[model samples]
Target: MPDLITPTTRLYRAWLDAHAEWGPGTHEDGFGLTSTDDVGSRAGFASWVRRLGDESARTTCRWIIEDRQVLGGIALRHHLDEYVRWAGHVGFGVRPSARGRGLAGWALGRMLDHARLLGIEQLLLVCAADNMASATTIQRQGGVLEGIRDTPLGPARRYWITLTPPIG
Candidate 1:
């Protein structure tokens, strides 16, 4: 079974293995990684992890792990900024090898619970226009289409998921 976990340096080797599988670049969404983040060295990785912890007030980052391996990641930003406006409140990615297992939607559902705890009544999720898989996942979670908008990365499909109060 896959478990959603907070970022920790204790899983350094496991994370490196997963990062290696991703090849290169900061395309690993949901990880809060940046082009300038140096995750190659031990100190660097630890620092990066610490920075994520420091941002816990504004963002929640979690990794999907099964059998001690990192399968993917998901992040929920608590507020809207310019980047959040384009990228939406949530960002996520499943490693190439872990595609097709419904991990994205599963993780997303958990994150929606988190959003509710934070009093976020609604969420905005945007995916590339060509990414049918992501679009489907969002829709499955009750996402309603809000149309597409052009972004620096290209045309993106925007969706909104309204949260209802938890049933007693």
Candidate 2:
């Protein structure tokens, strides 16, 4: 895979707009909004991109698939305390048009590499109980289920994926 990660830029705004429309289905009430655009407005997204640029947090990265379009993105939120208990180290969303193309697994594998670079020995990944796809992605990356939690949104499954030292 070519560099799936890139700095978020104006060039990606159109892709972001399209990603925003991939919402949760009626049966899956716990999936949350499927797109980051729903989390904020255009300006907010821009601001988020800026924050992600900060080296200290290394907060964001865009994942482009074979087409070189922003197929998805992974957000790494650092400096968590209580939130870490339930919140995962990374949050990800694959564009609606690009779902089920194995991008989530690919992007997650890249994120794990990035997390290792950031000195994170372990990672927490949370997914809605009903989101079998998300759970599979985490499992494919070697995540171990920790437990489940009841959030205001609904019940979420928490998994921990540890980065093991290379064997000689």
- List clashing residue pairs in candidate 2: none
Question: lDDT tens string, model 1, 1-168?
Answer: 999999989888988888899999898888999988899999999999999999999999999999988999999999978888999999999998999999999999999999998989989999999999999999999999999999999999999999987656
Q: Candidate 1: minimum summed lDDT over ten consecutive residues — where?
A: 159-168
**TM per candidate:** 0.97, 0.75
Residues 1-168, candidate 2, lDDT per residue (tens digit)? 535655555545554454556543322111222334332466755654565565335354555545456666666655455655566776776766778888788778877877776667878888888888999999999999988889666899999898864334
**Which portions of model 2 show Cα errors greater than 4 Å?**
1-3, 23-45, 55-58, 65-68, 166-168
Quick one: best TM-score, which candidate?
Answer: 1
Error of 2 at 157 (Å): 0.5
The RMSD (Cα, Å) of candidate 1 is 0.9
The alpha-carbon lDDT assigned to residue 137 of candidate 1 equals 97
Question: How far off is residue 48 in model 1, in Å?
Answer: 0.6
